[model samples]
Target: MATLSNCFQPLKFSPKRHRFNSTSLFTRRCSVSATINQSKLDILLDSVKWDDKGLAVAIAQHVDTGAVLMQGFANRDALASTISSKKATFYSRSRSKLWTKGETSMNYINICDVFLDCDKDSILYLGKPDGPSCHTGSETCYYTSVFDSLHSSQAEGSKLAMTTLQSLEATILQRKAEISESSTAKPSWTRRLLLDNKLLCSKIREEADELCRTLEDSEEAPQTASEMADVLYHAMVLLSVRGVTMEEVLTVLRKRFSRSGIEEKRSRKLEGS
Candidate 1:
């Protein structure tokens, strides 16, 4: 339930001054509390097999969501810097130098833990990114649809795979804002839902009922999945309309992680009473 926003600190930089000369920011290393001992880190670094170009594949994954944020190459210095700074630092193969993620874009990846793959030829960095990982402004490097239809065709016909719920929520919030500002334009389905509370509630109820019905039929697995998607979408729309964020909902869910379902329901009922 932990979000990327909670993990990464926002980077402050002036667009006018540092926009052109952002390379210097990458060169200067920031201080972070080191958890790993120098000796242990040295041994770990030594075990890694750097390729001919003195680089190893570094995969940055979100610690909470288990989503691969981005992948790049890392040298010994890059790995060392990443550990020391508690920020994702990767060796830019194209630039042939060490570059910290979010040095320019201010979308830095806050490091939680770094792991070496079984082969020791690759590294996995568990972290949370401040913003989109890709330069094209997508959440991750993988935005293009390829071979998705092959897998999705087996279930629920063909639907676009939504990997980042946070990103989708952000888009919905933005659309709501745009609709509020626009006078003549037709409001999106999300905006319309936000505008009409009764209609939104009705849609959510309808979707939930459909989802329940879908679950009753074992042969309609794909339809069940589709209905589930509808239920989630409508529920999120309700949250948006109520001025509640997905992150707030996630925070609540995180708090309930230690409690049993019955205990949680009883506790909520007790609080209401």
Candidate 2:
């Protein structure tokens, strides 16, 4: 009779040599990817101390949208592969293997931003995702399916800018879609304009040009609040269309706002305005 080892030669010897200790350190990754740039990554990775377990936390989101897509963990090799391949990959505790997110889902989004938490143990991703991140066809890992977020005064205090932006964008997109599919809404000017992609595109361009003009008209004179609001709203609409978020745009604005108004305005002129 053959020994048991003869039937399972590979498993018999390899288990001893590998000495792998399994744990409940499972990572849930997004079906889509978000990028973490070298600069933000430099700060994050440098702050974290990987233990003997060789595991670190990573939170994935859409690159352009800044939606929290999924969360995962990384070993040294997985981190390297994520940056090297420029794709989201994670070490799966349940499966006890390395798995690239979206391999089965076919909705893998590319990376746009990677960030490290203050402690550096956690990583955050911001990117444009393709479709649902969860296997069950949910949009996010958290299954808090359908709750009212807008028009609640209490929510206003707790709203994250990005979260609010995401919600608003979704609402706008849905309404725009509804308007598009309706044949009897032609009498409604706003509905008609929203339905017409070309018209929307033109409005976006016009607002962009107006913003530029307002910025250059005079350094000391800020545009009328109405004009500014128009520009901002239209820009947000365009951003939603492009699968970007107001959060990312605000990040740029925050950086710009840090400088003296005159200094910032002058710098733009210096760059061939």
TM-scores of the candidates are: 0.56, 0.51
Off by over 4 Å in 1: 1-47, 63-72, 80-85, 91-108, 115-120, 130-167, 216-219, 243-273
Candidate 2, residues 8-43, lDDT tens digits: the string is: 111100001111211111112222235657787566
**Per-residue lDDT of 100 in model 2:** 75
Q: State in Å the error of residue 149, model 2.
A: 11
Per-candidate RMSD vs. true structure? 11.1, 19.0
Question: Clashing residue pairs in candidate 1, if any?
Answer: none
